[model samples]
Target: MAKIEPGNGLTSAVSRNILRGTTESLALTDGEGNSFGSDSELNAYTSERQTDKYGFIGGAQQYSEQSAENIPPEVLRQREAKWLDMLNNWDKWMAKRHKKMKLRCQKGIPPSLRGRAWLYLSGGKVKREQHKGKFEELDSQAGDPKWVDVIERDLHRQFPFHEMFVAREGHGQQDLYRVLKAYTLHRPEEGYCQAQAPIAAVLLMHMPAEDAFWGLVQICEKYLPGYYSAGLEAIQLDGEILFALLKRVSPLAHRHLKKHNMDPILYMTEWFMCAFSRTLPWASVLRVWDMFFCEGVKIIFRVGLVLLKCMLGSQDKLKTCQGQYETMELLKTIDTRYMQEGFLVREILELPVSERDIEKEHLASVRRWKETRGELHCKALPRMHGAKAIMAAEPPSRQDLRQNPTIIVELPLATKSNGEDKERKKTKEEKNGKKNSSPTPVVADLEPSKPPPPLKDTALLGSNQSLSSTEHDTYL
Candidate 1:
């Protein structure tokens, strides 16, 4: 096979290392099939280089981890304890003390707890439990050839510079492959989009493959339906909403866009699709995600607006960008000053972009699109906004905590054939009079015993399938 190099507008410098020689590196295998290389090899390469906390090999190391490191260890322990308590009683905090939850999220979930917090926040834990073994089943099956081929090609392209994905066909890339390919199998209609690679790569960085797969599921189906779907109609609608909101949030920037006839799609596609994983500094990306999994897609909008405001909100700032190309370039290569986590997170939280505001614009945009362009090709399901809404729709139970603990573990595959295996084990246990060893069966906890009172801010919108439901277990 011919060697594929970086700078082809396809692969990256790190990926070039993987694609360097013979067809051997390109060959696929069953499990852990990426080319063999040692982390020691990658480490030696970066030994003299400056790497940020997330372990990207090089660059200016734009985001600082020193602030987090500089904190007293005791303070770090205290934060971890607080996060632990919150995770232990997540439903209570979500149901009543969501304001405090939001406050904690803004402060930033402890890095150690970030993965579990995200799983809980996105309701992926519930989805994972409700459909146990689903990921393994999908992993076992051969996915659509078309999607599988595309996914294989795109795996190395995601976060190629980061240690997790730096090695050729390393564990990081393997796990990333499993999550992305599993998603394609789970939601064949949506299939694979190149942008999802980075999103899944980020998730895998923080969580195990199964947990990461469910997290990706929640993102595609519950959080941003129609986003990765055919025609990407939902994103197009969101882009319009972002542009309309920009008119109010930053008129100068909005006018600058209008003056140049710059459509949001021209610049915002990668930003929105990847949720700024590719755009923002590493620390800033995590900060945004800390809120995003808790607050939903509105956080994405706020971050984008903040970037617009910082970059072109003023006449003076806009003066240098007189043409579309300059404006595009500025948006593409965001100023590092605005990329700092503290400044970026502060601006994002301070911005008054409410959920209602986004929904209102969405309604208007959808109506306008229908009147002008007719119905969209893809029909997106309505989604709960964030942790609060997701929890509101399907209240977690004490029994659930006992049965499905938050700590990551490989769940038993809940397939029909596995049911027989479970029965056999149950029968043997019963003969031995070890019935008590089995977990106590609880009443169906899909719907809360009492419906949660409506939230003050905005009403929860149920997706076509509730996160707690088992009917569409295949999807999540």
Candidate 2:
């Protein structure tokens, strides 16, 4: 991606780093499935040899993965064993992952486990030495230096079409902004990324700012590699991984996804991004989060694969729609009772998943996610416009808290005011004198202007209103 100059005039080095943040992270997972090392190794590798994924012209390391020998049997075996043990006894495995232990998550966790579970799952259970109390206080105030820019850009963009996030200026938007800014200040390194909004939004719902920041740090570090990148290749790579898994589990869906260039990662990105807030209900999100924190990143893939198969098997014929339509539909259906059933999780586990199932589930989920989002947003154009018009027409509340005080002012005392001023003051006092004496703000629901009285020549037996009193409360 080309660099867009930041409106904020950051120093050359700071701006460069911010621009390169995604590139730096992507240095770990380039295109063509070649990983230089874990994210831990990305800093050293990128610093020594600058540049990024798909930019390979003559780099030896970038091209080596294609020619590299198949992963050794022992390494694959250890990976399988490690993964199997985790699936069977998640609590035991996760206990070792964290310095301070957390219990296993519920049998099936949702996608909104971005905070508490994210931290626990990413080995961030222990207290961090940095930004303890400061992180907590960041929520109540305004204007944090680090996050103000990043947070402002994505106010409701992540799931802009979700009605829950549609209000132009409301509680959800405010809280999201506060939590994100706080986290950015708290972790100047991770700073803020475009993908952080969903995760931060989920955390703001469950936790105060400080804890949420720590939890976010943990998830980005341990559970997700794509979260903090410039171009977000981790999403593509992980989606490919899910695509591979789905093929093993469901061939029919695999063919569909392949036809449309769909992948399970598209459906599950929100799950990885915010622990599933975009996909699952709050209860399910937390439930899944509980397990996510207890298990590891693999659980995200496993549960997602499982959910895909379950959602597919449901109703024999999977629901049909366009790309966005299917994703939007899936988002709506994510909270249905069918998903909450315990047996579904067991069913996914029982499937041999032999590569083919994973591929199919991955594909079907891709289509479904696109459909789900379409319904959540684009389908609601009339309602979205209507809702926005209503919100705009309504009187705005006086909630400005960031205004600076101490402006120059030199108003004369009452005795010095002109007659017009005195008259105006008296009229204002008379208008408000009979109301409640309290100084606090008052909000009144107003009715729209009524039509002028009918012409005298055509008068009826009694005066009539074009609209009833109930109609006054609403507008067309």
Candidate 3:
């Protein structure tokens, strides 16, 4: 096996051949000793596999069906144990063991535990419980007819290679429709956006429809709020931020792109909006989502920066590219072999970028964008030309709070055993002179003051407790 060192360009024919061979080794097969030659072939084979095995009634197979089997047994056990521990003592684990959690997330959440872990990490469980039956309520109503056609058209386009979304009327696509429609009803202001389709599809792969819906809500509201809204103002602003970060991180590549009059929006809109779902390999996409849920949107920016550097950093690769079209083509079709899941994750984790760094750049970028807006006579920005600009001047309103309910653990006002209600009824009867009844003794409640019981193995599998912000904010 040959090692392709970082910074060594992939322009060499030998290196390219090695890369191609490695990629083919990971390609999907038709289970009859045949391999797919192209993405369409792979999709057709997987869709046929789904029909042959489970018919079209259930969800199609996931993109990376062998993802779990590829993990070493020892690693799998270790991750499973950690997942169980997190489940049993979720609050304490999230609060105290977050560094360990982040490290584990970087390694990769086990496929079996990914849904639960993501629900916990993204505060989805909290939101789900808070808005119980909300999806049913939303699903009962028809969404804005305007978004129905757009959502339906983009349904199959998301993860067309994945078995889950292969059939237009498959369980996966039906669930996807429900989730997207629920969201539009949940947040009528934002309605439906094309970029959200892939995001929801990926979520459906990991969790059920209702859970996926809440996960999407958490993402749009907490993780990347304004990015998918009508105007995509946040995305436009982040494009400038990404460009500024690129200039700092890879000045040479930045200069090359600028020289050719290439704009950040030219290549980064889908990348940012989809959170790399469409850009990275399915395996890499899962790993990135692990970190994205734990750390905020900074992960997206960092991954974007690293990708830019990988594609355009090498002088050898850039020298051959003549102009914006060539550069854009190169970027759009960058080889995934170079970005193998493990290597790409390691690179992203090792980057010197931080949340604080992104925040600083974001502030500056917003300022620059505002200045540019002023210069354009306060006209709609170029990015807003095609997209509707719902959020034009003011910041996103408090009404967004309604879209994603805050995490609230509703404690019972009084325990049934306490008989507080009984005592109230007795007092009212005595006041009315309707009956003479003894008042039930009030039991002093000490449960609130008592420390939580030690976690036991028996409690590992069925914990439904929602972690407080104290547990989440430390790392996220």
TM-score against native, each model? 0.76, 0.44, 0.67
> Predicted candidate 1: what Cα RMSD to the true structure?
12.7
Model 1, residue 317: displacement in angstroms? 1.2
TM-score of candidate 3 against the unseen true structure = 0.67
- Report every candidate's CA lDDT: 0.73, 0.44, 0.63
lDDT-sorted candidate list, best first: 1, 3, 2
Which candidate achieves the best lDDT against the true structure?
1
Model 2, residue 447: displacement in angstroms? Answer: 56
For candidate 1, give the lDDT of residue 138: 95
Model 3, 144-252: lDDT tens per residue?
8877766775565555445555544656667788899999889886778777887898887777778888888877876776766544556667788889888988998
The 10 consecutive residues of candidate 3 with the worst lDDT sum are 384-393
Error of 3 at 225 (Å): 1.1
* Candidate 3 whole-model C-alpha lDDT, 0 to 1: 0.63
How many backbone clashes does every candidate have? 0, 49, 0
| Colliding residue pairs in candidate 1 | none
Ranking by TM-score: 1, 3, 2
- Alpha-carbon lDDT of model 1: 0.73
